[model samples]
Target: MTTHANKKTALVTGANKGIGKAIAAGLARDGFTVFLGARDSEKGHAAAAELKAEGDVRFVLLDVTDSASVQSAREAIESETDRLDVLVNNAGIASAPGSRFKEPAEEIAASMRIVYETNVFAVVAVTNAFMPLLLRSDAGRIVNVTSKRGSIGEEGAWVGRPNMTYSSSKTALNAITAHYARSLSATNIKVNGAAPGHVATDFNGFRGTRTPDKGAEVAIRLAQLGKDGPTGVVFEDDQQLAW
Candidate 1:
């Protein structure tokens, strides 16, 4: 295993493409030894290779929906470094855009479960597995990539929208972020949620108005926060957002 005693190390899940990829690249460019976590080994390696010019980047296979995979990823990182300075839980899934909401209760429940497996439950599993390593860092940072639609305060805007699974999963993620931030308040760790507004990505059928790089700015900034940075907050661009 190779070690970088002088540089901070970061792990970003779902980093093979889209906003996660942009976050990995941004961290690597900032002199972090970034671990690009992807479920697909081929894509993970490809992304790491693509970012080699930026800094020390490597691929780590991580399937957030699987407990075994999450544990294995934690072990893999532990083998390389004793501490993880940053963790970006960016893996998430959404039901097909513009698809009709299932009329049957069973179908809706299944859809919600599928999305939650990746967005909500996986975040909890992955964070718990890496908590020890994060605590070892001098300035640990956890950034949960969330969405503005998760805001219950904004329900009026999406009252009739067909995004139950995706939006509610984000709401759960925001809550999870708050829970961790408060739990770890006495420590050096900072846990926060980031809303990447309307990014054009495969997840949304490439229909959003912003680019992935622009969407990743807030997450990258939060990841690099100092010891004095705020914890348990949701941020979009540079502004604090409502829970």
Candidate 2:
């Protein structure tokens, strides 16, 4: 097994494409040995290969919804490093592609399980599985990549197509983030949420005005937060987003 005890390391889930890819690239550039956690082996490898120019980037198979996959990912990561400095739970769906706001009410209801499974449930499983490694770090950081629509406190949240499942899932994720921060308050680990404003990615059918790189800025920033930085808060860029 390889040892990365002297080097900082990070893992970004759903990193084969979109904002997750950008986050992996940014972390790699920032000198962290980045692990691109993706379900698709081919795409994951391809993404890691492309990000090679940035710095040390590798691919790990991670289907967050599956308990076995999560366990395998943890083992794979543990094989390389004794500690995980950063964890970016970026794998999420704002409704399946092309079906956005078009699915029947019953269908949308059925899809809620899948949505929560990915955006909310998976975050808990993956974080818990990796928490041991994170605890070993001198300063571990967790960045939950949520969405602005999750902000029930914002007026815009109700203005959109009213994707109840997706929006509510994010809200649930935000609560989980806060609970994690509260639980780990006395530890060296810092937990926070990042609402990367909508960006032009396949998730939104490319309707966003921002680029993937632009969307990734907040998450990458949160992942590298200083020891004195605030925890249990969600930020979009430098501004805090409502819960």
Candidate 3:
């Protein structure tokens, strides 16, 4: 087994709060030098400081929706780290949980646009932008923090919920994972999606049954996959989730 690096670096996007924050803390506890990515510099620094008090952690200003911001983050990371061991796409938006899918065409379209901008487009942009840095590592892993609601099998469950916008965006993200896994099958990179189940997060007004710690479990596990571990798969709580 390869020894863990004393300065292994990982980045978790949208980590100012909720599942993303939990995941970043977990990685740091596991000995990674974490880069806590947040759109808000203030919150990002606060989170990094909280973890830095415990161990090594850095605050990175990253806005997945903005190409320039993503490029700048990539550049900063390149200058600071020799290689990126993990990239967790955990930042997302879920607006209007009670809005019905069939309520209005404009509403549905607007929701889709909002969710897709962060969940789908941002994941692709960050992953593609950081592929080179990941490839430089011996056992690079990419975990797309998705949800079971994204499963096509469960699409019926969200049909009337305008919140389906966030769920469907994740479905597309899973497709991107599969594509990237196939593209890198010959390489050492392992890319997969992790569903945190129904975690109690601000996104849903903290009504979810599971805690952020529980959700972070699968994400941290996926981030630490070995060279031979499975890829192009979706998991929830360490169990295979239906697609």
Candidate 4:
């Protein structure tokens, strides 16, 4: 395969479309060999083909909620490359009917399990599984795609928000980032969380104000962070977010 002295390898989960797809495209353009991970093979292959036409991009089958799928994806990567330079945990789900903040605990708990299964639980699983590959690199990066709604320090509490499932899931993800960063502090890897703000993506019915390209900006920046860059922090646009 084509290679370069400074070439990096990055994996972006849920990249079949929207903000995740944008981040994968941006990273590929930056000279990184990008693996576009998707749950659907058809959509994943199409996305990978589209980006491969522009640069070095490949398809990777990944289902955040499935342990077997995650293991297989990691094995495939190990077979192709010796190191993982970046890992973007962008896979998430928002369960309906009870996904709102005002939903009852019974409904909220159900939605919470689904949301956290993909957003929080999967993040930890993926990170722990790929960490060995990431450690193989000189400078490894991890960017957890979180949300502004997750900031407990500023948002007060998750109870009032109508978007409880999605919001609370992100809050748990932010905690995961901090915990992972602290655990890897002495190493070269830097882990951080990023909120895309209000991005116009299909997940939100494209109602957000910012474009998907704009939403992926900070995530890309955090992924390309140098050895001295900050870790265990939350960011959106260029500003550091609370909690």
Q: Which residue pairs clash within candidate 1?
A: none
lDDT for each residue of candidate 4 in 53-89, tens digit (9 for 90 to 100): 6579999999988999999999998888889999999
Tens-digit lDDT track for model 2 on 1-243? Answer: 464568899999999999999999999999899999999999999999999999999999999999999999999999888899999999997764445464335466667887899999999999999999999999999999988778786554576566678888999999999999999999999999987786998886799888999989999999888999999999999998776
Question: What TM-score does prediction 2 earn?
Answer: 0.95
lDDT, candidate 4, equals 0.87
> Which residue runs of candidate 4 sit more than 4 Å off their true CA positions?
1-6, 96-108, 153-161
* Preferred candidate (TM-score higher): 2 or 4: 2
Arranged by lDDT with the best first, the candidates are: 1, 2, 4, 3
Most lDDT-accurate candidate: 1
My TM-score estimates for the predictions, one after another, are 0.94, 0.95, 0.91, 0.93
RMSD each, Å:
2.2, 1.8, 3.5, 2.2
Displacement of residue 126 (Cα, Å) in model 4 is 0.7
Clashing residue pairs, backbone N/CA/C < 3 A, model 2? none
Local distance difference test, candidate 3? 0.85
Best by TM-score: 2
What are the clashing pairs of model 3? Answer: none
lDDT, residue 130, model 1: 96
Q: Which portions of model 2 miss their true places by more than 4 Å?
A: 1-3, 96-108
